[model samples]
Structure formats: C-alpha cells, structure tokens
Target: MTDQFDEDTGDYPLVMPGPLWKRFKQTLADFVLLLVNKCKSSYVFDQRLMDGVIQLLTGLADSQVRAFRHTSTFIAMKLSSALVDVAFGVGGSESKEYKT
Candidate 1:
C-alpha cells in the first residue's frame, strides 16, 4: 500500500503501520536533537550568536505553545520542561533572580 498522498487534491495518506512508523519518527527526532546540540555548542564563544539562537528558539516555542494550548497537557508539560532546561543551562542559577 502507498503511504504518500497526492499533492493536488489535499488528500492524506494512511500513516505507516507499527515499527516502521515508530522508527521513522524516532529517527527524525534524533536528527533534530543532534542539530540543536550542534548549534548550541557552536555559539558558546559568541554572545551575539547565542542571543540570536535564544531568540529563534523562543519564537518557535511561542508558536508551539499557542498550538499546544488546545492539545494534551502532557505535551505542554514536555515543552515547558525543555524550554526551562535550556534557559537554566544558558543562564546560570548563581543569581537568585535567575532561578525559575
């Protein structure tokens, strides 16, 4: 069975079944995480680069947060945790004001 859809009619295809589908999604997530980590490391020596990276990430998270408001709370929690982790890591907790 075909898993792809025709682009003209706006039709959707059936999702890949079982293990293959799981593996595909897992692979995609891993690739994304790898890219993010690379970017994070590459900006360590440049404050301007890090600010740009932080702004981009914040903008992305804002859009996702708006979208997630209608979805499951579990996903929102996961998103919140990830953002907090990044922010805390970037902004040291040495100052009490920085502690969330």
Candidate 2:
C-alpha cells in the first residue's frame, strides 16, 4: 500500500483504503512513536495534537465497517484511559519519559 503525507502539515492521510488489520497496526505504531517522542521532549501538548490523536484513534476504531460500534467503544475506553494517564504523567514509560 502507498502512504500519503501532507506536505504542509506532515500529516499522513489515509488516501487509500486497505485491510483493517494492516491499518490498525500502522496507526498504532505511529501513535506510539508520537506519544513516546512527545513525552520525552519538553513539547507542550496542545489542542491540535490531542485532536489529531483522537482522530487517528477514531479512524482505527471505525476501520471495520461490520463491527464499527464495538470497535469504537473499545477504542474510546482505551483512549480515555490513556488520556487520563498522560494528564497525570503516568502513561509514558520511564525510558520514553526523558530524551536528554
């Protein structure tokens, strides 16, 4: 499958549809890396970043048309918990918490 990245925002857009499993794996990996970097750096977590994460998770949750509701519910639960942990500074792993 081909990947599409937005030139202006450097955001990867799901231009082509693919298998649910593949999309889920890729999205999860991308999110994990982003979270790790964000936690390690002194970067301020802004609304845009949060929005993008939410959107990505939502897409992953709704990837399967047959079980959209169930997938979305599960994803929502995980996302909520993750957000809480991040807010409380307990989500990032020790190794990923500091970059320097």
Candidate 3:
C-alpha cells in the first residue's frame, strides 16, 4: 500500500495546500500552545523566558508568509489564556513543584 491517501478516505489529491504546508507549519501552533500551557508557572515568576516568547512571536509577525502569520496569530490567541492563568496564578498552588 502506498503512503498516499486511499480511496476509502475520499480525500482528493490536494493542490491548494502545496505551499501552505511548509515544513513544520502544521506543528507550529500546537507546539506553541503546548509550550505556553506548560510554562505558566515560569511565566508568572520569570521575565527572561517571557521576554523571549514575546520577541519570538513579534519577529514571526514580521514574516510575509501566510503560514507564519496564521500560526503566530493562533499561538498568540491561545497564549492569552496562558497569560490569564499566570495573571491569576491559577495553577500555582495546585502545582507540586510550588508546594511548600
């Protein structure tokens, strides 16, 4: 069996997404979301890592590619929830690492 899509799936040969599906484009948003979700604790108490996050997202916004812009925007939206969690310290007391 070939790696290509099977007729059972009914997915036609894709042409629209040829350029859109650049290397790691699909994983970019998910990776950022995972990072932001897991980093809430550090974000609440640290400035350096957060600064890097801000700078990275800002620089990604400077790209003219649709994939970069779209992924960055989606990551930014999801990141807001993480920021809110950090703002209210939602997981601090629940986190074992922060336990006294």
Candidate 4:
C-alpha cells in the first residue's frame, strides 16, 4: 500500500500515514466491532469459536507484532467482555465502556 512516487522521492523509508490507510483502518475497526457485537450466548459459550477469534487476531497481528500488541489486547478485552455479557444474558444493556 505504498506509493511509488513517494518512495522514488526518497522522502522516507517508513510507511507514510495517508488518508486511504486511515480509512482502511477505520473500516477494519468497525468490522471487528461488528463481529464482536454479534456475539450471542451460543457463540460466547462456544469454546472453539472463541479460540478461533483469538487465533485470527494473533495471526493478523503477527505482521506488525510489536505495534499491534496493545491494539490486539484492547480488542481481545472488548470481545471477551461482550461474550461474557451475552453469556450472562446482559447483552442488551450496552455499557459505556464498549462504546469506545
């Protein structure tokens, strides 16, 4: 997702933060939140599915392991909390914490 012109210009070696990247990240975060919010009691209680979610995140984060560590942790926490709420039959009562 790099620009050839930018690279040829010899401006920087690191990936530059651009609008498209920002939008893509926002889209990704939204998708993750949607997936997490869809967790019902059945999915929450399904050990296999929970493990899959964890594995998926870990695998994806492996690309930028160091940078994604905290982000992945936060996503994991939210997913866990959502699962717990659904399991406890309290999923309808949205918490302020999850809004972020």
Question: Which candidate has the top score in TM-score?
Answer: 3
* Clashing residue pairs in candidate 2 (N, C-alpha, C atoms within 3 angstroms): none
How would you encode candidate 4's per-residue C-alpha lDDT over 1-100 as one tens digit per residue?
Answer: 2222332342321223787766765665566656756755466557898788889767745534333444566566666665665545564455544775
Stretches of candidate 3 off by over 4 Å are 1-34, 89-100
Q: Which clashing pairs does model 4 show? A: none
Give one digit per residue, the lDDT tens place, for model 3 in 1-100.
Answer: 2234232343322212465554345465566657767765566358888778778877766665544555556667767765776655666656856675
The models' CA-based lDDT, in order, is 0.46, 0.53, 0.58, 0.57
In candidate 1, which residue pairs clash?
none
Order candidates by TM-score, high to low.
Answer: 3, 4, 1, 2
Poorest stretch of ten by lDDT in candidate 2 = 1-10
Stretch of 10 with least lDDT, candidate 4: 6-15
Please give, for residues 1-100, the per-residue lDDT of candidate 2 as tens digits. 1124222332222333458666875585457545645663343266666677678667755553424434455556655655566655654465566754
Which sections of candidate 2 miss by over 4 Å? 1-44, 56-66, 90-100
Ranking by lDDT: 3, 4, 2, 1
Candidate 4 TM-score, true structure as reference: 0.47
- Residue-level lDDT for 79 in candidate 3: 76
In candidate 3, what residue range of length 10 has the lowest lDDT sum? 7-16
Q: What is candidate 3's local distance difference test score?
A: 0.58
Summarize candidate 1's per-residue lDDT along 18-81 as a digit string, tens digits.
7866676556455544544565546544678646655655554444333222222323344445
**Model 4 misplaced stretches (Cα beyond 4 Å):** 1-16, 58-100
Task: Indicate the TM-score of model 1.
Answer: 0.38
